[model samples]
Target chain A: GAGVSQSPRYKVAKRGQDVALRCDPISGHVSLFWYQQALGQGPEFLTYFQNEAQLDKSGLPSDRFFAERPEGSVSTLKIQRTQQEDSAVYLCASSRGATGPEQYFGPGTRLTVT
Target chain B: SQQGEEDPQALSIQEGENATMNCSYKTSINNLQWYRQNSGRGLVHLILIRSNEREKHSGRLRVTLDTSKKSSSLLITASRAADTASYFCATDGRRGSNYQLIWGAGTKLIIKP
Candidate 1:
């Protein structure tokens, strides 16, 4: 793809339900990032991946939040027991090499927990 | 906590007018980047200025950095209606730590045609 892409552009789940969001990064991009953006706020980093290695998972908000990039080029963010506060947009970004480079972002998946 | 603070939370200008946004950060940085977002979805990279460089330009966009003050400014000259969007500033750290790019609240720009 010419740009990074994400699936399930919008999702509405009841509280306590589990949801999964997917991301397809640009081909051969070594760095992938996940961010959580609340209404009227900037993106907050969630986690990072270097190839298949999970180098950083520090920004994840809670134990209920989990992300994986087993194949390196694709990633998934899963949220368990979604809460009302989890209603926000989940964004995915990719960079060619790592750090310092500009990150290409996906359109993001908007999750609304009811 | 966010490292940068974008001043004038919102801005409005005419199509032919210029728009200027400012950003201030707390810590030392190796580089500062500006990005634009429409409807709060994806972000498009606009410009980047290194710590040593004071200014850079791309088309009608001009960026200036003052390392001593830990601040940067973005100027969009001869703006168009399509230029209306939120602008954010991000900084790198620790060997280009991918998720470590500290971001600001952003400035919402409205270009009236």
Candidate 2:
């Protein structure tokens, strides 16, 4: 079976620039999540989506961060005005059910803001 | 912030030895899960143990959950060089009608062949 996939495995953006990371979850996965992991640290939750609805965005750091899963399958995490502090690995994961304990992950997009 | 910590931040052992990692959390959880991540790669789900289950086994991986103490442990028996990686424990907590996983800092394991 196909696993979750993310685009732009590595991204380099200048400060003040905007970046968008894409995630393609496994076929028929209903729950999607986004996380940010700094170097040598665990992943920090960012947002979650149940189908096309954004269920939780409390973990989003600031207004500069936005996410959408318009079709309930593919998702995109956008960071506006990138900052050096925003440099980290952005991870995406999906589960079969809304509250499934097991989740499949994507390779993630490593964002570097210079 | 992380919910708890994984003890022995790092461990190094020879191949074919058993490796054990411990994790502790602060809140009640529905389940605890283990994940493995290799260098520059996504995490792979290793095992999941519900709060009600005391222990579980999958292949060479063994996971134990202690709800009373809010802790868990992952033990890998007869490990191989491929087992060298970071192992993380995630506990699921309530998030409105749903649930979200709270992750630990993870334990780095190094295996010498």
Collision pairs in model 2: none
RMSD of 1: 1.5
lDDT of 2 by residue, A1-114 (tens): 889999999999999999999999999999999999988888988999999999899999999999999999999999999999999999999999988768899999999999
Give the clashing pairs for model 1: A99-B96
Q: Name the top lDDT candidate.
A: 2
DockQ of 2: 0.66
lDDT of 2 by residue, B1-113 (tens): 78858988999999999999999999887788899999766899999898789999999999998889989999999999999999999887554233577789999999999
Task: Please provide, for model 1 over B1-113, each residue's C-alpha lDDT reduced to its tens digit, 9 standing for 90 to 100.
Answer: 68889987999989999999999998888889999999745899999898899999999999999999999999999999999999999987545443468789999999998
Which stretches in model 1 have alpha-carbon errors above 4 Å?
Answer: B94-99
Model 2 misses residue B64 by how many Å?
1.0
CAPRI accuracy category, model 2: medium
TM-score of 2: 0.97
DockQ of all models, two decimals each: 0.60, 0.66
